[model samples]
Target: MGRMKPQTLLLQSKKKKGPTRIISVTTIVFGSLILLLFVLSLFTTYRYWSQRSRNLSGNNDLEDFDEDGEKFDRPVYAILDTSKGSIVVELFKEASPEIMDKFFHLCKTGYFKGMLFHRVVKNFMAQAGNSQRVEAAEDWMLDMKPQNELMSTKHEAFMLGTSKDIHANKGFDLFITTAPIPDLNDKLVVFGQVIKGEDVVQEIEEVDTDKLYRPKSPIGIVNISLRRQR
Candidate 1:
């Protein structure tokens, strides 16, 4: 023990630093793992909350359409492709359930296709969906017999005019009013209103018409499509 060798001194120094270095490395690894786990947890929480918020917003939008004990989760639209132009109307199912059902059924079956806007009164309204009568005769009567009469006697009975029923005795005719007709409010069933392409309706209204308010040139409905709100 008189004098320690240089090699022995170096060995002792290495021994002295070994535990400290090991401790530092271990601490760094542990801290890094903890930090990574924390970050992952934050990301998971954020994703969960974001998804929940989106779900709640969608539910709130659906709730907005709830009316009179009926749920209208999404809006129904009627796109009329006429010779003049295209017109978009938003159907109010809650307002006129029976009329909307009939209209939608007719649209699906291509009933309105190639049918003329047979009746058009300036600043009043444009009417269509008289396919049977329109195609049957050139000079068809406006007060034609109800088409639904042959389908069912029960339906025909329901179609009889009543003071309280606006759609009474009306066939599957779709009428788009250019100006508000207060008297027709209770006398007619309005299933939808124009949301886009009001100018197209105006264009049809401005077209030359005969004495019976029928358009001189055929303004036929090429196609009709139904769309749901996004």
Candidate 2:
């Protein structure tokens, strides 16, 4: 057989390599498509579960004003456990009696445990309270009727306050404002303060939040036990 020309050899090499290149490119493209689909599915799953969880517990009413309303006189300390660190909250009962009473009862009855720190407004506040238990949700929503009463106070650095809403969910989830969102003065309730863990409160506030005020990180209430401070 005549020796193959250099051009012929080169042409034969190109033909052999062409199919390999096509196969490699096809593999890469297919892998990327699969990865993209997996990511989308994961995101969709996460969103569905999150919304379902919020809506299911959203109907809970945490406040029910009785015929004879109760008020707390002494200061109370709440021990909070977040995924980041421990937070010791000091409630000013004198400043906001009803608000503290409501918060106290919620803590005493184990209502705030297992709930997530759902909202975190940077340099403003961190909000939590929504449980996995069906009973907790039922208790929360039992007294959700609208109350015209607006509990307002000075937005002091350590003060704790409930948000205003037609129902209880907004107030049930409490937060501490970092910057004086002065506009919020009339809208939110100032109930307590961070006598000890201002730094921890600020830490929580730094958590990433979504438009709905929900945190991107899954921070939860490890515990919510309170004690009457001297």
Task: List the candidate 1 regions with Cα displacement exceeding 4 Å.
Answer: 1-71, 131-170
lDDT values of the candidates? 0.61, 0.61
TM-score of each: 0.53, 0.53
RMSD of each: 11.1, 20.5
Return the lDDT, model 1, position 195. Answer: 73
Quote the positional error of residue 134 for candidate 1 in Å. Answer: 11
Across residues 1-230, which tens digit of lDDT does each residue of candidate 1 receive?
59999999999989887454346888989999999999999999999998887565432233243334453556766778889888887666545555555555566667878878887777556677553443322222243344433432212111211122224435566666665443444344555667788788889889998866777888989987776652
Tens-digit lDDT track for model 2 on 1-230? Answer: 89999999999889887454345888989999999999999999999998776554322222232213455444556677667777777655454555656666676566777778765656555666542222432233343333344433464455666755515554386666665444455556666666676787777777776765566778887777665542
Residue pairs with clashing backbones, model 2 = 60-140, 60-141, 61-140, 61-141, 124-178, 158-193, 160-191, 160-192
